[model samples]
Target: MSSKMEKFSVLMSVYHSDNPHYLDVALHSIYDDQLVKPDQIIIVADGELLQTQNDIIGKFISHCPNGIAELLQLPYNVGLAAALNTGLEHCRNNLVARMDSDDISSPDRFQKQITFMSTHTEIDVCGSYIDEIDPVTETFISTRKVPLTHNEIIVFARKRSPFSHPSVVFRKNKVISVGGYPPFRKSQDFALWSKMIVNDAKFANISDVLLRMRTGNDMMARRGISHLKYEIKVLGYQRKIGFITTGQFIHVLAIRTFFRILPGNFKKVVYKIIRKCYG
Candidate 1:
């Protein structure tokens, strides 16, 4: 399918604490470096941003084609889930690609995803593998791959996320039909995927790396008590929805909680082992 015939929107949320430089690079990758540029780039400013951040956004906007970049500034920070839900409301296109403020997308990311989605009309959501890079050095760290078929995705979702949240392009209406993203501080994507799965929304993942995700000690540090709480909440929802059996929930929760409590360094090692085992 020609990208020109299937116009799509790029959706992203940025907050005060995000790195300005990273955000600039992310926007550039999805626009200047992309083979198929989005028809519209909708960025939700979750809260007040620094002057530097605003300046970077201004630079990006100035370089974009007229009406291609849209910035929605919120009066206050509403976190990721709420911010994304707000952004989704403004997405004029049926297909919306999700991008993180810190990730660098491959030049052909949008082209590949749009082509796959256009051909696979039944699949409402599509994601792909990601190459994890060091935040400081910008060197390759690992490749996080997800299941590539609907059945495999459903089975994988019972234990872990079936798709990389930042690497996904999904049908906007399908996501909204499931109540959009739940208002959670963390693991919102996990909950959203579970809801979509139970609601019979089809899913798939391209068997190729489409984005380079930044991961480092700071990322590992986030897997603490708060993250564990949200993880359990998502697991409980899965159990209630019958997406996962009680035994499966308990088993997965036990393992996740153990890893969550580990020191940042130890958690990093555990992450590598888990990825290697599953990759």
Candidate 2:
């Protein structure tokens, strides 16, 4: 690890569904990148991965220096939130960079994020925009952009997720102090962000894209009646934590309900409009 990034760990959670080959690509993108290399890569195995997945992880660990890649295995399949919470407890540094098992980080990602966190000591969490890509061919499909300032992020989080989950690097102590990621089935990150905001944690995101995220075709399948239920539940939690008012919670629920009933194509348009309006 380089001196510039010696204080951070890359935290990722993997499970059975994640593609082994994609995981290989993702790990290489982090380990074989630019001037700053992470001091530790803390990968939490959410559940039992396939033999192939285990082999892929072994291959990567063989190349890393001893103790650089730490794998925390769980006996059963825990959801993302719980898995991440466990990973957080094992992190060796205060600054932890969040990574998805299948997303590719840009060569300058660590350098950019580390520099930003070092200079802006008050910012507890920092994220960046990402390019959505077709996983098989790795072709860019679109971009997911977020607000770059603290106030904008707070406003945007009222309606949608303000930070890309896989592109964020945050202070471990701050996150842990706020109770870490809540154990929500679907909107865990959003829920955690809401809690962090209520705790007065400063947030920021770079305007430039710093990661390539693989989009599953069935990603939209996760957003229907069930997803709306989860969102409403998250909204309720946010209100309970005093992050949002009752009126704001009701307004968000109505908008989300309307979007849930719309056809897939129309929902895409509505989401695009929302992103552009918030962006």
Candidate 3:
């Protein structure tokens, strides 16, 4: 079916195990992302951790479309992939967009992304640029841009992930056909994109930045190391598709290192200048 004919579910996993205020902030961002009402927004919590999440669901339900927000507490900490799979199963939609419990998204995020998917038929998954937030100040943070086409992004595997996980809005059918996310692991988002790319799945990125990712304490905080690991692994996957000489791979690592030490505020200034000069 065409994306134009699709309804979407914004699936998020909650760990009442997590801090309360951050969760509230996340839901507010989700509601804000939907320019048009979504099919529903479902939250899943660990079963052993149900009561904890029940309190949270009760607190946030009124913030969304009537009958649009709901929660499920799983029997255990089945891992993020498993919890999300459970949410996907219950909330039927032609498209699925991943949302982290602590990030913020722009108000037109879904409207713009879904409309893009509707016209670009060949692309199976798409993502947009994001701003990395400073958790302490709750202020707007550094922006990161990604390449726009499959070929450009495949080359991106030579460095860090070219796309932001939370900024992705994708075709659900393609995800399931590619085997969804792996069970009990980190870099599940990276793995999903890699697997799809290896199988010739199409991709694209919007030129505009659409998400605000809070770092330092969020789930992706292990980025400094975990990303290095995922990059090496992604490089290996790309090599299986073609050739990546040892020299080129090392160069990629050097570039990644340069971006890593870059001061956040400095990077913000640099991006602002770029946006003004070119955008």
Candidate 4:
């Protein structure tokens, strides 16, 4: 490790349904493939995982240098937000990078983010664009980009998520100071961003893509009515926090609910159009 580089921890949460192969790929990308590796890798097992998943995790622990990998096992499954909060408490470094079990991070992802955070000490949270890929074939789909500067991100957060969750490296203390991730099962990242924004935490996103995110066909299916309910809760919280005005809240909620209720195929098309226009 370079003397100028500050040590950081990689935090990930895995559950029963996560694909073992995908988890293995994600692990290797952040460790073996990275130009700047993390000082510690904290994996929070959200629930009881399959034997195959455990085997994959064991192999990864063996591959890492001694004391680099730590596993925190949960007796039962909790949603992503709570699981991450648990993992956050275990992070040994003040700077922590968030990783998803099914994403492929670019080798230079950490190198670039660490360099940016080291120099831009004012930024508490930094994220980047992500390339969406087909989960089955790993084929390129499209890029999901976010705002690059603090002001732009604050404005962008009014309508959509200003940061890609898995592509972010954030200050641990800043996040905890804002009460960590909110309790929403969905749109928790959006809610967290709103909380941080209201708390005056600085944010930024790199203009370049730093990770390949797996988007399965069920992506649209996952955004059904239940998802919309949590989204509405998040929007309500945003309004309460003064992150968005009542008018903006109603307008965005109407648009989101309309798309959420659309037929699956039609919803996908609508998403593409929206992404092209705003993403």
lDDT of 4: 0.91
How do the residues 1-279 of candidate 4 rate in per-residue lDDT, one tens digit apiece? 233778999999999999999999999999999999999999999999999999999999999999999899999999999999999999999999999999999999999999989888888999999998999788988888788999999988989999889999999999999999999888898899999998999999998899999994359655877788888899999999899999999999999888888888888887787667776
Off by over 4 Å in 2: 1-6, 216-218
Residues 1-279 of candidate 3: C-alpha lDDT, one tens digit per residue = 354645678888876566676777778777754575577888887555445456667877876658788878787788887887778777777677778887888888888887887778787888998877777666764567788878998877554466788888888878888777755355567666767876778889998878887763232333454456656665555455444567776786676555444566554554455434432
lDDT tens per residue, model 1, 1-279: 333447899999999899998999999999999998899999999999999999999889999999999899999999999999999999999999999999999999999999888877888999999998998678998898899999999988888998889999999999999899987788899899999998999999999999999985468766698778888888888898778899999899999889888988888787888887885
Q: How would the candidate models be sorted by TM-score, starting from the highest?
A: 4, 1, 2, 3
| Number of colliding residue pairs in each model | 0, 0, 1, 0
Residue pairs in candidate 2 whose N, alpha carbon or C atoms collide under 3 angstroms: none
Better candidate number, 2 or 4, judged by TM-score: 4
In angstroms, give how far residue 273 of model 2 lies from its true place. 3.2
CA RMSD for every model?
1.7, 2.4, 4.7, 1.9
Candidate 3, residue 57: the lDDT equals: 71
Using lDDT as the yardstick, the better of models 1 and 3 is 1
User: How much lDDT does each candidate structure score?
Assistant: 0.91, 0.88, 0.71, 0.91
* lDDT tens digits by residue: candidate 2, 185-252: 88899999999998889999998899999983336534778778788789999999998899998898
Model 3 poorest 10 in a row by lDDT: 216-225
